[model samples]
Target chain A: MPGNPAVPVAGNRFCIVGGASLVGSATAGELLDHGAAEVVLFDNFAFGSDAAIAHLKDHPRLRLVRGDVMRMANLLRATEGMAGVLQLAAYMTLSMDRDPWGGLDVNIRGVQNALEACRANKVQKVVFASSNAVYGYGPGVSGDLVEGTPFHSVGAPPAAILYGASKIIGEQLCRDAFRKWGQDYVILRYSTVYGERQHYRAANALYIIETYDAVRRGEAPKVFGDGSETKHFVYVGDLARANRMAFESQATDVAVNTSGPAPITTLELVRLVTELAGGGPEPIFVGNEPGKVRLTSGGAFRIAHEEAFRAIGWTPEVDMKEGLRRLIAWRESNEGRAAA
Target chain B: MPGNPAVPVAGNRFCIVGGASLVGSATAGELLDHGAAEVVLFDNFAFGSDAAIAHLKDHPRLRLVRGDVMRMANLLRATEGMAGVLQLAAYMTLSMDRDPWGGLDVNIRGVQNALEACRANKVQKVVFASSNAVYGYGPGVSGDLVEGTPFHSVGAPPAAILYGASKIIGEQLCRDAFRKWGQDYVILRYSTVYGERQHYRAANALYIIETYDAVRRGEAPKVFGDGSETKHFVYVGDLARANRMAFESQATDVAVNTSGPAPITTLELVRLVTELAGGGPEPIFVGNEPGKVRLTSGGAFRIAHEEAFRAIGWTPEVDMKEGLRRLIAWRESNEGRAAA
Candidate 1:
């Protein structure tokens, strides 16, 4: 708290934990493009696919470290001499439903290990990748979801609640580290992220890819329920910029939403995806999937990102149309289809 | 879901994980009095004390098993042949703040281990001791904290949020087990407990013991803030009975609050404790103790236990005054002083 908390990108070294996936790869490129001296991508390649980071593998300034967050030595060694660490390793709801033990271990203890490594190595700042899932799911989740919104889990599935609570615990672990050891940090509560390098693991963002695939196959895109449920998302590039801004800003010990400019309904999203994918038949409405873990909200809500501007002077630059268009183009590309 | 979910105590066997403590001892006695064939008390005694369960040690129906919840083998062996298992092994906010590494392991993974053990053993019912902290802290938490109340963490200390979120994860693990393996469970969201065998570890319940100690030393009891902060507590005996009722009822995969008849403000609670501990000086208003973990609520709230009545035909019979009177009586007795 005594001196400036911001770490300049140029000539500085950074490490991205779980940096082989969608947001991680984007943020790594953003940091590298900004003249970072060295950018290390630490991943165990468990959920992280090699195809996701193939573009960056040959970059001279980028180094990929094969490591697991559950192991302290991996984090300690990878984080040594780093100026900042972007902790992005986690299991979203789908993977959590399949394996909660591994998810909780990575989400909770993984964050703890990352922070401890930062402390041990004297890393200047940590920009932790949190999620708007911290606001939780259910009827109680509606309206503007600011950083202070309580987690609502009344009717949410177990895996969804587990994922949200684990994120909440992860954020608090950062706060605990800050209070206990003055480990500077900024928590970015990202909404569903979409765009180039979009992954299929996220429950909400999967709708985009699934709808695109259906449209490509000349099948009608499917929308669950009335399709009036709100879905807020940020472009991966915008999130990448936000992660960079978090390190460049003087913000520390704060958490803020980093959502897109506005919200979209499921119906609108499907229609948009259909149109963007060239052409498609009329969409069909369907009931909930029987055994699939789906995240449902009681009412429409928007994850506000004004606090991100105030805390780190960052804002979403990509609209849904533009972001989804990028995602479609990527899906048509060899790299994206290979990842798919 | 096929057979009777209820496991009657008269001819059944039970295991209490983290059993050598306040609620554990009280619930152990309740089961024995109800004619349980055998009751196993499993504990690591890390935070649990020997004096806490001394009175129940010699009972012919009770047996103590030294074990750690972290070790799956310990839980697997202890939970074998058990009809019902009450998981009370956890770190409150104070202990969580001290050692989060251990706390997360015990609270999150420990619950997973217990549920896994129960599933492997084909245990009929699991009574998980979740806390009203799942409702969370800060201003968003106020008025009628029913079973569905969302968790609010704005302006709360990190330790408190971590503790609350850990409990949320624990409950979801129970739900996850029920969904995955048909593991029958009843999650009781207990409020702060105060009665004959009270402990000093809980942030809110420690108020009673601290006030009693101050009054006993002829010093004015201390009240933090304006002392209007609400504190809702269930009697330890009532919780014990609720545990029994939970197992005896046919309810499965249900969570309900188990609070007292009502809530009391800090000032009223301090004064009541002072009165119960013989005549004492006027209570002193003081600011929060620096560097100490204190759970401060944003506004007045009551943890409604009405759902418990509906779910398991259980209701709190003890109010603040009576619960405090029993605590006072115990404090003056030989066993309580010896533990103190």
Candidate 2:
């Protein structure tokens, strides 16, 4: 049923680095579903979920290799004979801010290692997973966050955060690699992606998942900010499809913004999850935020997605309402399986 | 003589990475002449000439260490307790074009290793040896170069040429190190530098020095490119002084052009060398026919060196005519010593 002419026919090998993570796993699934002959998942298990890896274990076309990207030998070995590489292995966002050394080692050095391997292996294309955090809260609407925007994150609040700076540096690495190697590459700057398999301990996606779980358990869903801040919450499945589209598109110089078309306010998202969970409990809004506050909401993050759609002839099939329902259902099924 | 009211009166310690090379050795001498308390020369002798290292071995305040910058342990050991670092150790212009792997490994990875050492050692100032070759031959004026011109370089040139791209990448590395670590760094984008102790076999400087030697031996000097091509030649001593000034400057943002005040036409330069060599031979100007012409001779590679001069009170006292005469004398003396 996933027959699409744009999707490369089966027997074409595709390798997804960091394939055991939320995005990586979904990308792997999409590639296999679209008839890739074989999908090799390369990951070091740093932040990748075991369940995601286990779910794909039974797929005939999927193979898993546990490896770190920092080691060039390992990446080269895994990338040998691969047709294309989707580099998704990277340090966690929170990890970047806390452990800058690890972040640089993994993000910058690791990415270079991957590129070197790809170049050596004669890989046809490389798709890098970048982030919207590189935007660092556009300067009013006029900033309009274009690809060519001279990144002025020098004194920005996010620049002070190591995670955002790593993303910026990663983008620079991609640009340099393109300039130097002329390799067909695409940078997917994903927004706040959330869905099943997201770690409940992580900040962005965990907040929503834990809040819904708490409300269902007859506890209040706690909110950090004034409940007025907003962000674009893209479903992980949709992000995976976007990556697939990018791989299929012939566009060489592409850095598509992958996010939900509709920007959902944090408070509204919480309320919708609570409603979907059958009016479990009221959300306890903790007024006044502590950490960095970037209300990068509304239609601002949607611009790149529009560009992505026009370029690849693709769109997100799952809306927030249905996406949330699917997440809640997955959570319930997992809970039931645990109880049994 | 090297007193600067800008740099505090306390003696300054400097670490010169790859300090055994022509540029590094020259820079070391300049620093010593300007009154640096101590200078440490770090190199693995990868491409550094042994004679250059031996020449400075007797200096009272200078020390030498055999170590590669690619090894983090070696870099850390070499840089420990230094107040300033002058990084000049790199694969030469012709070498980079031949072995790109070695070029990337040494130029990019080697730079990172040095920077990591600098951060660990708490080195106060970093003066990176960059090149104007990064600008690739500009239009109109042969030497009318500026700091803001766009970079252009095709793969390795006639001689395996990773030097240009490596310098460009090196500049990026410095920028990243500054942004991430807040370490003060100055990128010295140098033009064709020549003086005593420089090897006579290298391409650019070799042509000039060989011409001088041939004239001294009563042989005709050959000129390529119609005698119209020009080059900006800074005396090695002046470049060394610039390094000192860069180290002493308090400004964090620093990337300045450093070249001789006068642009030397290839033909006129040969004539001056002929006269300096006691008028042994006239130069034969070959017309502007090109097989592999490095036609960067005319116009202004001269930048606002006044910025550096004001900052550190550095003045190039060695004029080209006197400098060439001195170079010929040094070469003759060295040959005599070798024969003895």
Candidate 3:
């Protein structure tokens, strides 16, 4: 609390680790628009893509650096002279299910390497991107999920639990750094992100794209279960603003949820997507996919974001309907289609 | 279920990774006593000490192999020709708090290397020594803690969370191996272990030793809080048998709790230790240790071991009173003093 924890965006250099993805690119743009002196996009491009970041690749203030978080040397080089560091590199449940070894390396060790580099270079503040997956998936995961919710993994798959536990570890690693070296940091637990520049990665967000694709192909969108399942998502742009605010604000050594304006049922989500894609046939109810990692909660749950308002003076601005409109419009655009 | 999952003890070879400490030495003795063809004690002696295994060092059937779990070649060579491998190498909360780098490498990477070696060496069965710490610590941790209990980590120290998360990862890694290949394994989520050959390492069990030592020096045993915090612990010998039966059973791709007959409050535990050590002054109520990683629960919680009985056909036989008696008697002996 003593040495001015807030590192303002204007006239300051910031680095976005894993900076080619949806949240990363949007956050890079947000920082740049706020008159940041320089914004370094550091990524190994393992999961990041050129098309996702192509729009700002040539921006004057944005510089792209190819680096892997697995290597300390790469991070040490990438974080040099950075006022703030945004750690957005991680493997979601689907990717973790496929390759846990690489996922663990990136999610666990990658965060460690990034934080170590930040500490070594004396970065003023770090904004770590965690997830609601830390609440875990299973029967015990229901009701209002606050920052104090314990992880529930009774019937969840191994990869999902691994992803959640890895995030928990990452958050704790930041806490450890704070206790050890007084490193100022804020952990933003982003829910499933959607909207412009949406990737085909996250298991939860796949419903929107899959539904839109099915509707566009003149087919009925598939709705698994009765679709009463809850899905909380924060718009990528909203999360971008949260990242910028996290650094610009005086909040440090705290974690809070940055969910969207509200939560929506799966049925509502699918219908919203279909309507946004210019109306389609009625949905077809289906059972669970045999091998895919799908997160199922016990009942209706809301990941409240009021803490974000108090902690970082930020609140989500986009609702599902408005967010879906932007997403469908982006999908129809030239860049979004090419990126897809 | 298509093939025999059980790897019987008689006339079988086994490797105990980290088999130089309290549980490791006891387990080695258990396996040898049951007519194992050969037992390899593989350890780097980082946490494993010479005195812990001094009693069994002269046994011809028990071979002491100096190695590190971080080294794949070491694990591979040590596990070769073994029918089963018991992975017991890990850093507890205390050690994890001290050196998180070495701890994370050992806990995460060490387990990975051991499992990889088991797969490479064609080890028939693996009995992974998980802990009740997987249920985690804090306000959310109370009531009956069963095998499927979700992890509760609110208000817990960073090291404790890291330790618990690492074990969760370890258990999931075993499940992942089982799904990827047919790696038959049983994960025994052992609670705070105490009995003969008890080390001064574990946070919870430290009270027992500290109490006994205090009694020996004519001082009062110190108790934290109102001394009603619940502590469920498994006797080491019973855990040793549980490990043996875990390999010898048909259980595979399963995890269960291996707690004691019941839980004891801090005051009761201190009183029991005092009585067992031939009576002493009343326990001194003390405040929480400032920088210590003492695991205090929200309320009294009992880690149920019913699932372990169903999975491995084993249950806690030695009650805490009896287990502490043996521990106190050992403390009065030459071997225990030398080990201490």
Candidate 4:
């Protein structure tokens, strides 16, 4: 099994490149719970906060490395002796719009550094975090978005296109690494991760917490456009499992979608969040906020996770309702309160 | 005329980033011929060479500056007192496939550096050389490729996607600059450029020179696949004219395609080149070259340049046969002889 790219989690070492955030912390906890010998949370904490990883800060099996991916030397050190490395650091559309210079540095150079690190360290498997934004945004993105869906960037904003393009570049870098050096990698195109330790960063998933917060404050939850625009999000824990499965399974040089069970309209999502937060005033349908980089899909679209199951034998176990319940419960918890 | 975006060509200074290559030299000649006050050719000569710009090296109005686009300080100094800047620095798919790290650096960050330089110097206009590759490759790319065509990256190689995505990023960076600081820019999505000073770079345009060289050497020209693949090429001089018009016209915050009069099939191109090189044996159809990154379009596609004429009053004047003749003539010239 020299180049057979499969590594089980039990008693193995794992490194999450953009660790200290929602999916990173969740994946770390999941790996640690599954008897991982060591889980290194490597992060610079630029967008990542200590609060996100506070719950698992003292775990004996976990270690945190403060480093920047822009530095190849840092990555060369961080990924050493790890069985698997999950690269999760990137700037979302909003942040990309704010500071593209930093965004491109972290997204493109960051992924390259992590991959180079994996190559140098001879890591067994890599689970790269690609996004469904690779399908791109705007009117051309609709219907069942499979792995073969072409990147549709027409009519999209610059930052959104940049973020999507960056992800595309990152995914290809993984593919390139695999082809060049036999470095096995699985690119999981996660759709809008939302759950516990949810940071208000992503353009799509922020709507959930924003809606919940509005309801909590006795204000009407605002839905941009007709609220019929579809959002397919994968729960962070489910995505965590997908990341683990990608490493453990015999899947290599493949990319697949890791979306939630079903798509949700904005109105449905707002209502669900309102209901989860003990019900509030009626929702308001409003125009898009000025100067906000909102990712708008033209028609109802479902990101098919069938390919993920086909590729890695993993499926989303957390539905949005159940996922929302957990997120709301965590929001009410002391850690969430402290983090807020 | 204060704050007016258009910069008259007669006496205005212009800077061409990555201006030691084919398009850069052609555009420099065009600018100098139009009575430009000064034309600064700033380049690092990484992919560029002195042979490419040897013909115009001693032009009094043209100043050659060795500078890397990754360095903002270099760009700032280069753009000082410039009326306009034409950013021609980029890595195509073949080079991108080989060294993505360098490609991404020069394509994405290089563009940002150029824009920042233009911003710092209060440059009136910028002409960014984007590519029709923004329409992407493979089956998804066919028919009339207008500016509104969605980027189709499915089934394409990693380097091609990365290159296209990088150009998309560069174009968006131009748009972002326009929005952020009212920096006027015209993104010219040039199709495969071919003419005098044709280099070994550019995957598509290589076919013409390769075929011509093979025929001249009394060998059978090699054609990949059935040679029915489409190639839309704009002469370098025409593209240079388009770049000048982009700066001279009042058009701003616009992107348009600058393609040749029409596209030609690979077979037609090979035959034409063979005839131009003094006829040889017919092209030998062959499978894809092993380990070579060939950008294969599934169907016949034409990159429309109507918008270029509408936007900046520019059109491709030289047809393919004429352009290839010029390219072959240059290849037979003393400078080309020295370079070869």
lDDT of 3 at B264: 96
lDDT of 2 by residue, B221-257 (tens): 9998667566767788888878877777764445667
| Poorest lDDT segment (10 consecutive residues) of candidate 4 chain A | A147-156
**lDDT, candidates in the order shown:** 0.93, 0.69, 0.92, 0.91
Best by DockQ: 1
TM-score of each: 0.98, 0.64, 0.99, 0.98
Question: How well is each residue in B130-229 modelled by candidate 1, as lDDT tens digits?
Answer: 9999988888889999988899999899889999999999999999898888899999999998888788888888888988998999999999999999
Between prediction 1 and prediction 2, the one with superior DockQ is 1
Per-residue lDDT for A223-309 in model 1, tens only?
Answer: 999999899989999999999999999999999999999999999999999888888899999998898878889878999999999
The better-scoring model by DockQ among 1 and 4 is 1
Among all windows of 10 consecutive residues in model 4 chain B, the one with the lowest summed lDDT is B204-213
Q: Compose the digit string of candidate 4's lDDT tens values, residues B16-116.
A: 99999999999999999999999999999999999888889999999999999999999999999999999999999999999999999999999999999
Q: Candidate 3: where are CA atoms >4 Å away?
A: none
Q: Fnat of the models, one by one? A: 1.00, 0.00, 0.72, 0.83
**Clashes by residue pair, model 4:** none
Give the local distance difference test score of model 4.
Answer: 0.91
User: Candidate 3 lDDT, tens digit per residue, A1-340?
Assistant: 3468899899999999999999999999999999999999999898899988999999999999999999999899989999999999999999999998899889989998999999899999999999998899988889899999988888888999999999999999999999989999999999999989888999988889999999999999998889999999999999999999999999999999999999999999888888888898999999998988788988899999999999989999989999999999999999878877
Model 4 lDDT tens row, A229-253: 9999989999999999999999999
Off by over 4 Å in 2: A1-9, A71-73, A76-82, A97-102, A112-124, A132-142, A156-185, A200-233, A251-255, A262-303, A317-340, B1-10, B20-27, B44-58, B87-112, B115-340
